[model samples]
Target chain A: MIGRFVARRAAMLVATALVASVAVYGALFIAPGDPATLLIGGGKPPSPQLLAEIHRQYHLDDPFLQGYLRWLGGMLHGDAGQSLTYKDSVTHLVTERIGNTAFLVAYAAVLIIVPGVTLGTVAALRGGFGDTLVTVVTTALMAVPTFVMSVVLIWWLSVQWDWLPAYGAGEGFTGRLEHLTLPALALATAWLAYVAQVTRSAVRAELASEHVETAWARGVPERFVVRKHVLRNAAGPLFSVSGVAVAGLIAGCSIVEQAFGINGIGALLVQSAAKQDLAVVQALALITVVVFVVVNTLVDVVTAALDHRVSLEGTA
Target chain B: MTGSPPLLVVDDLRVDLPTRDGMRRVIHRADLTVPAGTAVALVGESGSGKSMTARAVLRLLPSRARTTGSVRFDGSEVTTLGAAGLRRLRAHDVAMVFQDPRAHINPVRTVGDFLTEALITTRGVRPRAAEAKVTALLREVGIADASRRMRQRPPELSGGLLQRVMITAALAGEPRLLIADEPTTALDVTTQAEVMAIIDEARAERGLAMLFITHDLALAAAVCDRIAVMYAGGVVEELPARHLHERAAHPYTRALLASRPDPAATAEPLRAVPGRPLSAFETGPGCAFAPRCAHAQDLCHTERPSLSPAGEGLAACHFPAADARVTPQPGARSTPHGR
Candidate 1:
């Protein structure tokens, strides 16, 4: 069953990636203005012969569909073509910045999931004042946009207190961590609220389930009941919600990256888009789509495995 | 049965639950005793407080419920037991089998894990030893291939098989008092009899006392030695199971017995007691069953009757049916009422 599910998901991933590549490629065609004009000189009108040569070099003179097909063929062979603005291979540019974005996302995920799930569990178990406080605080936090949070955090920590750097990806391991802290926090704020709300409802529902009641009736200790029954059963729903949170975090990172001046793929995408770097934009958009699809598929598989009632075959 | 000390003694147990309106009394002055190595069934309709009375024995009422009473198990005061004391009492002395086996057993966990969890966690038994004991108990409950079933989850098993597994888990603790709360309600008729037989055999082999709760008086009579009939949250009649049909001293018990549909007597339709069973909020200062009782009089509405000795057991009726002068009303014969 597991092997079949994995095979099916692999097929789905490839199909989705192909479709995403086509859609991203189409965006470049529909976008106004010519990349060759921006590449040669932004405002100056170059000689006609020089412009024609530049268009030929970048394959801009070919039909849009033909150019896209050629790009797709090259991508299938592990080549993403060259960036118009960076004057480097698209793969090389993405690979260089992907690690920074990954680190930032991983840091934010840990910060959001750990405390969010823990406090949510605590709030569910100890309901009166603690539950009310968590609900009120998380609701307020969810209302604040991520970019607004970034600006407020930057002003408070950097401009007012001079505690951490407001912008730039710092050097070395410790320095990089110190630099990512502010950006990660800004990105995690909204996600933390989402994860906590989901966790709270799931834990509360599990606690009231008849199985937990049976555990208590069997004289099992309170701690064991929570660990073995409540948390284990609640894990399936939590995984599903966390998958959505991860996708949202990826999208939110671009805005946060621009705010903090971190040279991650998000920052790269913003810069390339402004410069009309079609090759880089198409590559990054496809990567984002692929990541979202893969994460969602993994979450569904794990949820089905954890909950016996959910059939993987039925989903397929 | 009369000479031995009772295994469980519940006296004047009253449970009041706080609702949106006010504090509503659910169980009022309920008294019962299950002697060592015997079975007692608390029989009643739904909302009659049979399950609540059983849950009160374990102090497992909902958070908003307030209970005031004495529940004694083997000379220990269950009502006053501390958290550690209650835990020890629950682990070593008593265990409960619920109605729906599927709903009660954790779905993600295997049958073996569900059965041996209490033994390993509460009794400090080794895992290997607990596994062996669980397998043996499963066999004792008539489940085949115990080892294979242990590895499978609850959803893979039938309702009857899961119920038998629930019994095994309950008996795994070697409890002195087994509270089976409508354990067969969710099963089919054949499975019900099989489950009840398994419970009876296990109880007899271990010499355990049981408090069985059910709405079917006939099923209760077949398995239990004594029957305690509950009405409007109070024990209206207590008698030997054999005496329930012929020598019943309470009008409600007589009405209940008459309501059962006997296969042999198809000439007459099943009789159901008149009027809806009163809820906790609906009962008054008078006898709660007065509105539905055929023998109800002006005095029956003025004063509430308390349980008093009639013949071999107790009945709480002003005009006890055991009196030779009072014959059953002619029209009160087998007429079906609402369930």
Candidate 2:
């Protein structure tokens, strides 16, 4: 049963990517941006002959369907055409920058899920005073937007305290990790509060459920009941909520990247979009769509695995 | 009520819960006893504290609730038992089956997990061995394809099937006593009979003592050897099952007996008590049922009555019904110890 279920999910993942890729490519194609004009210098008016030569070189005069087909075929292989301004392979540019974004997102994911779930569980388990404290702190944190959090964190942790570097992706593993810490924290601030609140409500609901009561009444020890019954039952919601937060992170934190001077994919997308670098934009957009679809698809599978009822409903 | 030693005794149990008005009592006074290998039914309407009394046996009360009475199981006080002792009692000596089996079970888990979790975790039985044990117990509870049912989750099973699974879990502990809290209240009439039959047969085969809680007095009298009728958190009467209809001493007990529609006499109008049932906190110093009692005199309105020997049972009424002999209906079903 599990094998068949996973097979269906795999099919869904591929189908979702196929549909989204087409939409992103088509939308970007129709969007107002001329690559040939972008490639020629904007400082001086170029002759018509030079413009036509550039258009033919990039196949800008080709029909939309033919151009899309060519682009799709090239993407199937290890090619994404060439950048308009940088005159480099779009694929190589994306690959070089994707790693930094991936690291930043992973760092932010931990900052969001770990502390969020821990505080949420504490709030649920310890009612009265402690619960209100966690709630108040998270609520206040949530009110601060990501850019403001970035500014405040830099002001307090980096600038005033002189505790950590305020900019750049840094060098090597430890150095990069240390420098990325502040950016990840800023990016995770609002979402951490969101996940924490969601987890608190979910855990509290599970605790009040009859199943947890049954486990307690059966003489299951407290630790076992909390781990096996309460948390295990609450796992589906946690996975889903965190999955969304992390998947959104994969699209890239442009604001954080800009604030911290990190040359990640978010910065690349913003820079490329400003210059009308359609090739890089198209590639990154495709990757973002795939990442989002894949993350949510994974969430569905894990959720169905944790909860049999969901799997049944999914198949039904 | 029997010569056998009492397996469980609850004496003058009172549970107070926190409320906006202050500490309000939910269980005013409840006393019950279940002899070894005998079934005793605590029957009452909704909000009668029958379920609360059953829950107190396992020390399963709200964290903020305060209690004033003692619960003894196998001659040891359960009310004051330490954490370890409570765990030991719940694990080996007693187990409870809840009202809604679906709501009480982890829906994500297979029946096997629900059944063998305690055995593997607390009892230290090997996983494979626990699985085999619960599988056998499942078969005993009338689940023919025990192995297949074990792999299935709760939502896949019908109400009757899930109740059988609950019975298996309850019996898996091999406890001396089982507390069934309205085990069949959520099922339809036909399924109710089947589920009750499974519990009855399982209890008989294991020779387990049972404290059955239900609002159906007829089913209680049929299945249990003794009956304890509760009113507004207090057990108002205790009597042998055979005397539930004709020899019941308390007016509240008689009123319940009358309130049940007589199926054979369809031409007669249905009977209902005069006042709505009161919760434990709603009662005053006087008898909780006084406003609805036909025999409520000035004295009955002023002071509450304690359990005193009346007719063939113990009653908590100032005026125990003495005219039962004149009102004996030959249509009353003769229910002996259901074997």
Native interface contacts kept by each candidate, as a fraction: 0.76, 0.82
Clashes of each: 0, 0
lDDT (tens digit, per residue) of candidate 1 on A1-316: 6667767778988898988888899878888898887778757788889889988888877787898999989877868888877899999998888888988988898889998899889999989999999999999998999989999999999999999998988877788899999999999998898889889999999999888888988889999999999999999999888888887788888999999999999989898989999888888888899888988899878887888667634544
Give me the chain B TM-score of candidate 2. 0.94
lDDT of 2 by residue, A191-230 (tens): 8998999889999999999988888888999888889888
Q: In CAPRI terms, where does candidate 1 land? A: medium
Segments of candidate 2 deviating more than 4 angstroms: A33-35, B1-5, B20-22, B329-339
iRMSD in angstroms, per model: 0.9, 0.8
Q: Identify the runs in model 1 with alpha carbons over 4 angstroms from their true place.
A: A44-51, A61-65, A312-316, B1-4, B265-270, B323-339
Report RMSD (Å) for each prediction in the order shown.
3.7, 3.8
Best by DockQ: 1
Error of 2 at A177 (Å): 1.1
Q: List model 2 lDDT by residue over B42-120, tens digit each.
A: 9999999999999899988888989888898988999899999988898899999999999999998899999999888
